[model samples]
Target: MGILDQNIDYDRPVKLADGVFWVGFADLEGRLQCNPYLIVDGDEAILIDGGSRPDFSTVMRKVLQTGVSPRQISHLIYQHYDPDLCGSIPNLESLIDSAELKIISHADNNPFIRHYSVNSPLLCIDRLERKLTMRSGRTLRFFRTPYAHSAGSFITYDETSGILFTSDLFGSAGAFSNWRLFADFDKKCLGCEVAHPERPDEHCKETASPCPWSGMHHFHRKVMPGNRQLRHAMKVVKAIGATMAAPQHGSILYRVEDIAAAIERLQRMDDIGIDGIADAASCPA
Candidate 1:
């Protein structure tokens, strides 16, 4: 079924790969949607960026729909310390109730993540050699994308499924009214003509047109620190050679071509984060 099919039930766990599931709450009215992913390998499961406190029940319900109990979750990987990603830590710990459960993240973020009163032992990925090997022999690699949006930002690449869980690096900000789960760009969009009809000769990296690029541009310009940091993160993304990219918010880039297009667009684009602030520096004192 198509990812944007309205008939498709969003309440249930949507399988992205063999054992990978999107167990997030589809808040259709929210402008910024959060996506929590579940990677089940054998009997053990890993939850990535579980949503906020208010989203706990819905996210938990979808997690349960995957036939994996909360107890089966062996780790919760928080890419950063954002509340939208790990605010439900206490609630999740209460449910999982397993002493073996670990909250995996970069050491830089542990201090901030602890503010949520997470009881599970924080497993610093940097100390663990930047990788997690499941009992089933599935290895997940972590790459630090520092200052992409946070000091401790990182991306998780599942070697088994070739899916990169890019925290906020490739995230978009599309309103739920016309939200799509996947970045399925049309033929005209791929040609860049649709994105820049008036200036077809220009190398159109982004546009005001209605497409995934518009949302991506809007998000990166607002959240990313600068072009240098964005390029640094994009380099890691390219080096990983992930077949698909699942971000914390917005649509998933399921197509390899779409993923490549996104990387290319982000690389050439400029004026992000602080640089995008036009009149802030001139504000009257």
Candidate 2:
């Protein structure tokens, strides 16, 4: 939860890569900016992580602005439900006219997704083989990082763009203003020095006492249990040859060293035994 220090075009989709767009919505204060990605190739399209129930109209409006018809989206890849991920399933199913709108996710997501609508067919990803090739010549390799945040948490890697769509790992706060088609590794390396952010409480109240962003520290702790899962996730994403890492909540990471540094930072967090679980009052933000 970071509130900004710069300007951003929050009403529309922001391009993150060739054929890849960030089509998520945010509150006016830019605090609850849950991110979703749209990947398009010719007439075929894929959507990753639809925003929450309240975000349906804005998300769809921004997405439709990109010229992708609902029928063209043959695949819906939800990272996890948790309101922020698959809350728009009901709307998407109604809006998209494709009979082939196949869903791909962990089996644990079946109940949550079907709760919205029983019509969206789900295809579970294989952990061993770990890859799904779409009819449009795009291959999505899956990584089952169970319990990293959610029991069914997993990630996808796009072989074409060399981009890894990790659900929550390596996420940072205050992404709306800092977003770019590519990661600004140099500026991110300096952390909150680039932008003087205020905590969500102070930000909402329009108060002072501005603080420095801990760089995914709060998110990792709140969403993830601890280092045991993080270590395994690090190993899963380690050395994947990903040119950029797109997460659900943070700005995408785009440089080799930047990605590596993020891994190392998580490694250090684990070593220090830091935690961010909401109920754990002992853990500091």
Candidate 3:
């Protein structure tokens, strides 16, 4: 995939299926953007991850366009507590009555809400035993994947559409418009680096530090940590045939078969000494 670093046009309500849609935010040169999903069914709606503070305006407008009231948003699922994933919660709640907002996140992430997620309504599910079915029939089954990309993290799979809303696991760079399946982007030569005028290649390097969105500190202390978790996640996703991978940042993938292939290739690289620890800054949202 050829990497195109250009300003992206923010679009609303890109239909993914019968009840699933993507609300996107633009970044420099089509490289970074916030990806928030609106899962709607009749009178109920669930926002997978709230966008950045600035993107909430677009999100609110989009939600209203669906003819659903602000109070109709029944759930806010935070795949992780990253700022890009849940930063706009406080802002969003201020506009809408979040009294009914059910904040669902990994159990390990509940405590990180020093101020952002503290007072709002929430449901933190730390363990996964059975599949969770949303009112829209979107089934979510999670696999415990500690420290795959973040500590106390888990990747969720939707059984109904076979979509995996993986939070930062095996993520890459691409603007909202250029995003396609993993294979499509890779074949087109798109890497994670989004070009900026002052520092075009600055986001390429990988480093270890605290997570900016959640103030979560991280270190490379585990032995083969990312690889181990990635391998296990691949097996879990493969068993369920996950077709699309929707992350907090960049692209709503529709290439399931290619995603499986990418998993294998990533594993093989791990065996060859390609450490999975990425520079946190390289994570564009």
**What TM-score do all the candidates reach, one by one?**
0.90, 0.79, 0.71
Candidate 3 lDDT, tens digit per residue, 177-276? 4344222344322222222222222322233211111100111112225556666765665666677877665445567544655555444444211343
The weakest ten consecutive residues by lDDT in model 3 span 210-219
- Highest lDDT against the true fold, candidate: 1
* Candidate 1 local lDDT, residue 256: 82
Model 2 clash number? 3
Task: Report every candidate's CA lDDT.
Answer: 0.85, 0.71, 0.57
Mind sharing the TM-score for model 1? 0.90
lDDT of 1 by residue, 119-168 (tens): 88998998989999999899999999999888889999999989999989
Error of 2 at 169 (Å): 1.0
Error at 270, model 1, angstroms? 1.0
Ranking by lDDT: 1, 2, 3
Q: Write the per-residue lDDT of candidate 2 for residues 142-221, one digit (tens) a residue.
A: 88888877788898899988889988887655434433433454443433322222232222112232221354655565
Query: Which of candidates 2 and 3 reaches a greater TM-score?
Result: 2
